[model samples]
Target: MGYFVNVEPGVNLYVEDINPTGSKTILFVHGWPLSHKQFEYQFDVLPHMGYRCIGLDWRGFGQSDKPIDGYTYDRLADDILAIVDALQLDDFALVGHSTGGAIAIRYMSRYNGKGVTHLVLVDSAAPTGFTKDTADHFLHLALNDRPKMMREVTDSFFFQYATEEFCDWFFHMGLQAAGWSTAAVIELLRDENVQQDLRQIVTPTIIVHGIHDRVIPFSQAEEIHQQISNSQLLPFYYSGHGPFWEERERFNSLLMDFI
Candidate 1:
């Protein structure tokens, strides 16, 4: 159920499609320095519930092709469009996390939410990008010592206890990405703002953010909720930046209810 779809010449993205013929379809886009594999917990259960779960690794991350350029939000969103066309996906729920959430917002506005039914943003880095200082710090760390940066990010990911083994696994996932790609994306997250894109969205949207999120604070989520006329914000009190994994059962239940 996993394969690669060509987004452009010499650029193919890795996709994990489970329950391909299920009654409903949900397309997932992962965050920075991670792959579609980040949604392993959701994929494990949603497929059994008769939902077709499709997760794609954007270019330069996961098993996807890594090129020297095309890391901008617009280009990344175009990549999603290519997958949508290739799969002939329609009336599907779109879910995105962190930087993936920002890309999802771009996709919705740029494509006018063509085939999307419901939109979900989990601890998204959107409506606004990271501050220049924070971005600079991460960029420097990524360029010089990526492992250290990944370890720091992993440490701030969850509010709940994660085993040492689990933290190592998460850290390695970031390492799988190309260093150049990682730096390029951090730049995009610093430069690109999606407030206007939020206004263009006509799809019913839900913003699921952790109150204790250190990466993208809860205040940003509040701003996202305010900009989208039809959107609602749900705070994860007992979670940090990764409510999806920190509170998987509740996150999955919320998705089922919303979609």
Candidate 2:
């Protein structure tokens, strides 16, 4: 099933609610410059594992409404809350990747994770914001020719084993993202401090990180695992920034175990 859930006036978040027969649900939040389509692997495999998978496109990405406002973390959290309430979801696991992980932190902290039973962070950006230099470097890259920028960023950082066809598709997916949200959220990720939010995660959590991650680094995942009272770190030894693509089978197996 698909939904254009109304978040606020003139803003409807696009959500794909797949396989409704299962009793357990997993809500997936995608990373920056990408949409829930990023989790096509999970969506394809998880349903066979008896999971009802729900994927959302944030307001400014994918098929969701691209409003000029409401790009902040707090707004992102509210957008999630709107979906949770709309679906009346309970005892569901919330999975987030990259920037979405930080957004999950904000939601769990601010809302106390009311309907959530478990939390999963995949190569998340949390506990520590990006350093000024690193942030500035990414900002510079994003400001240049957008398509070329996406190609460069994907090649240089996101994947180590991705084929040319995969890279091309990934670049196109990113190019569909709103320019304003892309630029603004980079600064948001760089400047917003989420250590306190990380400390407040009461839900049983698992932090997954690729050992070879150059974009967010593996240490960031360690920091998240260390701070969350009920959290464990799961390392993707042979993967880079995107283990879901680089190591799909292992990633799926670990995720099934968590479920």
Candidate 3:
């Protein structure tokens, strides 16, 4: 079940935590304007694999605090560090998507990446700028023409990778929750591009991406694989950005093996 966690004094952080009493733990970090709920499918299936899965709702999203101050990467990364210490998790797997991916990378670079035994990046942002023009071009559509742009993104993020129902809850989450402002999300996106170099991750990393991912094409994953000295790439042929949603079973199997 999910809980209202106090990552720090007066800081109410929300986490969709499920400790199946498994020996191994996996901490799933979500991206911008979304909650820990993004990993719902993962939580449901990973446990049976003898693993405990936990997903965190980053600040400003889900039930977490959304104060006007402290939305920067340094601040977000700090929150993650706090959660790690608060929960007393160790030897866990760290999986992140999109902006969450950047946060994980930053965490590995800044801190010792405590308790992180393995890393999985799902269509995560590179430590640099991507097709900003493509994303920028869709801003008006995502705001002014939200439904239309949502459909397009849904197709690329998951529908192209799996069945229609795979992304039903994804769009539902957007409708049920108060989303991030366009300006704030745009600012986050602008900063999501990495300015620092992190091509030398010292851990076992698995970079996964869908072949048809319009957001960050497969080439981006290729670059990530080539750069991370100890990492490997696992490509999905018929998926998009949210490959886990598209091919749930396959995604789970791959994760089980990788972990």
Candidate 4:
């Protein structure tokens, strides 16, 4: 159940759609430096529960077309819109992790949450305070020493113990992305702020964040919960940036309960 959907003239995003005939659908947007594969744990179980799970790789990442431009949040969100239209998806729960959550926010605001029934943000990297210097430093690392940069990201990804094999797998996923595209997204992270977009959301929203998250602090998730009118905050006490994998059972249970 995997295929490519052309989001634009020259770009086609890779999508993994499981249990396509399920009554309930959930669309997953993965975080930065990773692709739809990041939801491997969720995909393994959700489909068996009679839920249709759809995950997509952002342009320039995973199996998607890599272009030099269109890394901005607006354009990224537009890509999601194209997929929705192409798949004719309706009343589906939208789940996004880290940077993906920020993109989901943009999609909700920019497209008026078209066909979205529920919104889930997991350890979202939004309401950021990133500066130009931060972006430049990360961009430099991405272009010059991507392996080192990805290793650092992998080290801080989880609070629980991950096997050496797991860490290697995660690190390689980041490396699979185009170097320029990785830098472009770092710049997007530096420039974009979705606080206003969060307020504009009328959809029922859920913010699931790790209590000990080092990348994006717990405070940001709290702030996001406060901004969204119909939102609830669920903190993953024993997790770090990746609750979906770090605490897969609990995360899946919460997601099922919410949906």
Question: Model 1, 1-259: lDDT tens per residue?
Answer: 9999999999999999999999999999999889988899999999999899999998999898999999998999999999999999999999999999999999999999989999999999987768999899999999999999999889888899999999998999999999999999989988887878988987999999999999999999999899888999999999999988999999999999998
Q: lDDT of candidate 1 vs native?
A: 0.93
Report the C-alpha lDDT of model 3 over 94-159, residue by residue, as the tens digit. 998877887787787777677788989888877653356655755666557655655665555653
Clashes of each: 0, 0, 0, 0
Residue 28, model 2: lDDT of: 94
Number of the top-ranking candidate, with lDDT as the measure? 1
Best by TM-score: 1
Model 1, runs deviating above 4 Å: none
> For each candidate, what TM-score against the reference?
0.99, 0.96, 0.87, 0.98
Select the stronger candidate by TM-score from 2 and 4. Answer: 4
Q: Write the per-residue lDDT of candidate 2 for residues 1-259, one digit (tens) a residue.
A: 8879999998999999999888789999999879999999888899988999999999889999899888788999999999999989999999999889989889999999979999999988876657888778767877776676677668855546677898888888888888877877778888786788888888999888999988788888888888898998999888887888788898888878887
Measured on C-alpha atoms, candidate 2 has an lDDT of 0.86
Worst 10 residues of 1 by lDDT: 193-202
Q: Is candidate 1 or candidate 2 better by lDDT?
A: 1
lDDT of 4 at 35: 93
Displacement of residue 44 (Cα, Å) in model 1 is 0.8
* Tens-place lDDT digits, model 4, residues 119-155: 9999998777356886777788898999998998899
